[model samples]
Target chain A: MATTENGPGALEPRPAPPKEQRFSLNAIQELEEIASHYPERKAACLPALWIAQREYGGYLTPAAIQEVADRLGMSYAEVEGVATFYTMYNLRPRGRHHLEVCTCLTCAVMGAYDVVHELERALGIEVGGTTRDGEFTLSEVECLDYCGAATVVQVGDRYFTHVTADNVLNLIEELRQSEEYTPVKLADAIVKLHLPGSSQTGGGSRTGEQIRNNELY
Target chain B: MGIRNLLFEHRDVENIQDIAVYEKHGGYRGLKKAVKMERSAVIEEIKTSGLRGRGGAGFPTGIKWSGIPQNDDKPHYIICNADEGEPGTYKDRELMLKLPHLLVEGMIIAGYALRGTAGYIYIRGEYVEPAWQVRKAIDQAYRAGYLGKNILGVKGFNFDLYIHMGAGSYECGEESALMSSLMGERGQPRLKFPHAPYPTVEGVWKSPTLINNVETFCAAAKILDMGGAEYARLGTERSKGTKIFSVSGHVARPANYEVEMGTPLMELIEAAGGVVGGALKAVIPGGSSVQIVRAEDCPRVNLDYESCQQNGTLLGSGGFMVFNDRTDIVLLMKRTAEFYMHESCGKCTPCREGTRWIYKILDRITSGGGQPGDVELLLDICSQIDGRSYCGLGDAAAWPIVGAIKAFREEFDYWIAHKRSPVGPGHVPPTPEVVNPLLTLVPA
Candidate 1:
């Protein structure tokens, strides 16, 4: 079946994991805290996937899914199914500064097409393809609930609203340089990576240890 | 008669999320007032206020609370539907980002009324800032004694709220799907039998749960403070209270506007700083799922449920997507259909296949391969998908094609006749300046 080249990389099969590793101590600690909030262990599925997406660079890997499944006492297929069902859980890899342009009704009409086209032209790839420098991958997604900010371009955790085609290139360069992301990481900037609950109660848990950043996951 | 701004009253005020600032401006006053009131009285107030769910389905909020069985053995849950993913909607995002306490306060009151011990704000993953702000507000509320084991030192009334993130399934905005996603499963909507329990009766963990919109919860708190009867006086007969419309696209000033219900459709557009280039082509009165009406026929339309329904469109999630004369109807319909097609959970056959088929046909026609009978086929497919699929999404997949063809069949037919849209590429418009904070301008 020929997939429409509309949204970048939707129909393409997700890449297989290169290797496997257990969740880091901090990730386990965070997952345990999140798991405590729910009545069932499975309810922590989205949160676990979020941690994996952050720990791994911008995508989920099969190994990470298995680790999450193991932690939640669910089958790999079950976790994978839950992970793949969500659009935010990227099965394949995304670039360093993953950029998504909202191309739904509001943004599409409000210059989203132009934004995507410009991003593609600037990056020298179509919507689904990634840049050779591994800096950006442009994809058009559904609404982000920021419709008023038409042509809403989401990069990591930041939403750059109302970006036109004319300024998108500059916007990309700016976003690539944009700092501070979500999905709690291990570092001195632990405030950005502070897991909910009492992981930072003592003010001494800033181990400055980075989570293993597997590029290919 | 005029714009009514309740939810967005302090939208532009800095540090509104800070508990001190919010309370100083009467933030938790509703929660404080409701806490001392009897549990039944809180529910009674919401019932009297006539506040309907601001989520797509205009279900009465007070009546929804009345459905939950209080003495049920299982503990009750209160889920805040913060996953505002409907195309052309962003009002909840602002409410959560700017005024997070309103949601927290609303949840506390609603949970207290239903005897719900736990609450969750199921926010969409794409909403990075709103979610963070909400989490911070939750912490603030906990520290301020507005939440937790004994709020205001009131015993036997325990309500704990947590913020959860959804990866990205637009269907999760639906209560059942949201529960499924919450319980670590694929977010698919369950079939509802008449006698069978709803989320309020048999929801997550098979317990009675109440899910309300961010705006609904905020309005609940506001209703409690303003007194139910006073709140009921606003809006039309059925649609009460001021609604926050996320006005976007083809407008000089596209932003969130809170207007009294039953405001004329043209008036809301004017409130959003009027049409760009001083011309209007069409208006999607609601979100993408509702009908798309032409600008020529919009004056008869009002920003209420009854008026939109009378005009052959429903005021479903006031995500107003306005289009100007420079826009292309074919492309809009195509994109709208394409969205539902992509978001379909594939649980049902009709919607799963029908949406894609309709999109492909539109794709062919819009790309200049349109043959005769394509429009009829699209309409036929839309009818098949509508009312046939299990959930509202399946029915929603039909609206884009049905509404577009209904209002602008000739324009769609024009694409088929010409084998291409008259409005083509290289005609990308400029972005309207997005105001950082959507506040109504008060002339000094």
Candidate 2:
């Protein structure tokens, strides 16, 4: 599947999904609310898809694309065209855990190439290729623009920087072994900033006081 | 650091922002010279010199000038794109704040070269001081007979200048979107096809117009004065002339450096204080949209468009952001993705939906939601958004998310597996609010 260098595959672009499959009622209501922010319905496509992709998983199943189109009052083709154009909208099923490596110039210069190769070796899949166990899929992408730190990778919503091949290998093994890990609370994570007047000091510290604790915001 | 002398030698009587100070420093000399030359000669000179646009695209400025229809009947508009919104980008603001007349002079030269009578400088609203400086300069120019009607006794070529403000949309940085905003419409990009049309043939009001970046216009005066060959000698073969790079991130000195194109990257880092005493992890050679270059990748990379393209990154606006050893790729993804998601114009589906989808995947992965198949899912989503969006914004928005995953998968794997950042997550960093809402609050 990855034999081709780049560009579209041999198959013609697929027809858009049917109207009913575009979205569910629950998502439609939310999209309508997002549409209110912009005068043009087209402008809501991004925000709507953000919510829709969350509801539909990694890929924008044909039905999900159609639903976004229907909600935005745009044609299925327009919606499909947009979905297929960007690298973010997934068109296929993916593993339960996704890993993003920053190959932007900065990361690449910082031995990101080796990090990518390490993941491929660990998962037995090429960049942009999925693993047989559906546990990890890896791909190369542009800069995350966190030039303050290189060798950065994003897993889920969190960012990990200053990474190496060894760091990645161990991390992958830990993830595969740990089934009890759960997401940290956003509010708790956010509260660790220790605002000047705020009373919370050690009240909400999660584990290691990291970037979330720094009040860059 | 006090007025680099080349651009400020004569203009340092006081501050260039004031008309009196600028006039004392031979401010309108370029305009004066420009008024005497035929428009054809000015355009020819620029084209021959091979000066390119300074606003990242690096398209030859003279060719753009020549693209305008010479015999067009419609009124031509000339605009200066001053909406410098790229994060880690601030060179335009520095130019405007220190050398307002340089910009005005550049605009005059560009207007003459393009035969435009009506011109505007679209200033970003957030930059109040620079906007004020430009406004003052234009008023000064009008008073000194540099703008409006015939200038310096040049007959039949009248010029008028105006200042237009943008409503804080990064999309406006795109040329088409900038045109839409200039026309009082929402700042959304239009379809670009065929040979990039000369703006003068079909620009603002569907008439012939020439829209140039602030830096591009400013470079015009210098290029005309030096001639094309002299100007070409400064930069590399393909990328001619000096480029103003906005240096930021983990460095001792985070300021703008105007250097000849193709200068080595390691030199820039060293000049900026050599990574601030920490491990040099990565470097963003261009604005946030360009691919990130890892520290090891910096040896051969030069600060020019051709070099960047050859190296798989781009010299996008020269907005360099540096990262150190402490930075987390996942945090970078979330922050950048969140920015794209917030700023997404929702014009096309790929960018609109794709941005958010990646953000969610990154969010879940970083938040300790380690599913077995998450990585494959992420790669698949990125492939869908790569070339499918309607505008570059979609591609711009998606690059950081996908790139982070590509270069730093292990960090992500660690977060998913450990339920904490692989670097040791405790609390998320707080984002800074640059604009003060309280400043707008008036006492009752």
Candidate 3:
């Protein structure tokens, strides 16, 4: 039978979801601060949902969605709808390191197809499957917004571009074993710090060398 | 043509987001001049410069700005479409990450032109570093009197700007979709054409709005600084000024390069340190959505709006992605189909279902399944989804698939005929009977 937990027919005040119970005081403060950025509290739906997902361990659970709704003054349905919309937000639990490999046109043409296959083979899991050891989850994503470095494989927030079957495993091993992230050559460049004075846009400079060197302070 | 490093210059400088470093390289010059110039004068100057929208549409920026109702009682809003979610496009990322002031100064000028009391730069959520840089620049602008009360210390010239990060949604890059997201709604494209209440006429709480791409606004700042007529002299008749192309894929150096609009596409490829390994076979002159130009026809393709359009492609977002002869065309087509399907937003039935349908068929072909008439079916499906969807996302999904099939039907057919996966090192035919549940086109 369809219950009020899944429907609007229930009468009692809905119990707090698991995420709400697990929500740290700090996360609530962060959500409140983020809510203030929008003119309407509802406008913080995306940000609020993101916080809930992060706190709940890299995925959005039913509890997390309900918690967001309660905090944002939204219905359970409204919160659920936005949370499930974007590909970035995980609806289910992910592995410790969620690897999102870009399979868009550029990345695919540059052999991202092989990259996905290699990841699947090495991890012994298909795309969208979690590894048996619970260390990794592989997904074929759209874009990491860095097309120049095609075939971007994002491990959590870190992006590994120009990945191939050869070096991608080295990268995974590095991520698994290393203390600090020591990237393969291409990925190393992707994480290069965007220092002062040098920027991609400004001052009619296309060679990107106009402000190449400037005082740090 | 040599590198015309206009906006892309000084991208790597340390502390590039600092107001002082930005000012060192003639930053805020356009905003300073814009404060002096009358509002209409700023709009008119942009019009004369012939700056077109950089966010794939190639719409004229001046004409779009002129559409805002100045006498309306409703508050006007100026939105910067920094929510760049296109698969192969990252020029906007380069701009926001490096030159925060360029976008901020551009927003101030555009805000002045549109007479918008408040402004918002709707950036995508995944851009953690860019958002931090943008907020830093906005804070710097407020302190320098470029934003907030009395911009540039002029009396009654109060203006405020804020950066709003979007939760990852590709459709949010659409103008109406962006507005919907900004208003705390689902990022779905509002039906405007053949309907009333365009964004310029009524947007963001039913008020007049002037929304533009990050690159377009940045260009506007430059056009104002340089004489409009002089800026007009840079490119072809229809398209003017330099365009930033984020060249990646099979290239030695995949970086963002801004070139004059009419530069040949091959030159842009060379500027990206040329294609890696074998000879160049195909090129997506714009981002992934536009029609793909085969290698032979690529040289004739100019890096401008009309020229690319004439050549059966587009200068979309200038996200130039190259592929060498060794690359698999069919796999590329499949991957492209997968992107559109995932990002369809599920608002329009045709886009939602049609992209899925195409992806299903492409999966079938790539999974070593063959049908005699699959290519025709793919093209037919594209026709159904192209103009019928509610928004550009569907059209974008349709174009590249149709273009790929039209350009390289043989490669697709080979995969089907031989039941081979064109991916791996050699002609690796599927040794295992891999059944994709989505592929259901076999004539049992």
User: What C-alpha lDDT values do all the predictions have?
Assistant: 0.77, 0.65, 0.75
The candidate, 1 or 2, that scores higher on TM-score is 1
> Which model, 1 or 2, shows the larger lDDT?
1
Candidate 1 local lDDT, residue B327: 82
Tens-place lDDT digits, model 3, residues B12-115? 76667788988888889988888898889989999999999999998899999999977766677889998998877888887886898899888889888888
Interface Cα root-mean-square deviation for all models: 11.0, 16.9, 8.4
Deviating ranges (above 4 Å) for candidate 1 = A1-19, A176-217, B422-444
Per-model DockQ: 0.30, 0.02, 0.28
Q: With candidate 2 superimposed using the best TM-score fit, by how many Å does residue B237's alpha carbon deviate from the native?
A: 0.9
Which digits, one per residue and each the tens of the lDDT, describe model 2 over residues B107-140?
Answer: 8887777777677777654444455556656766
CAPRI category for model 1: acceptable
Q: How are the candidates ranked when ordered by DockQ, highest leading?
A: 1, 3, 2
Order by lDDT, highest first:
1, 3, 2
Best by TM-score: 1
- Can you tell me the CAPRI class of model 2? incorrect
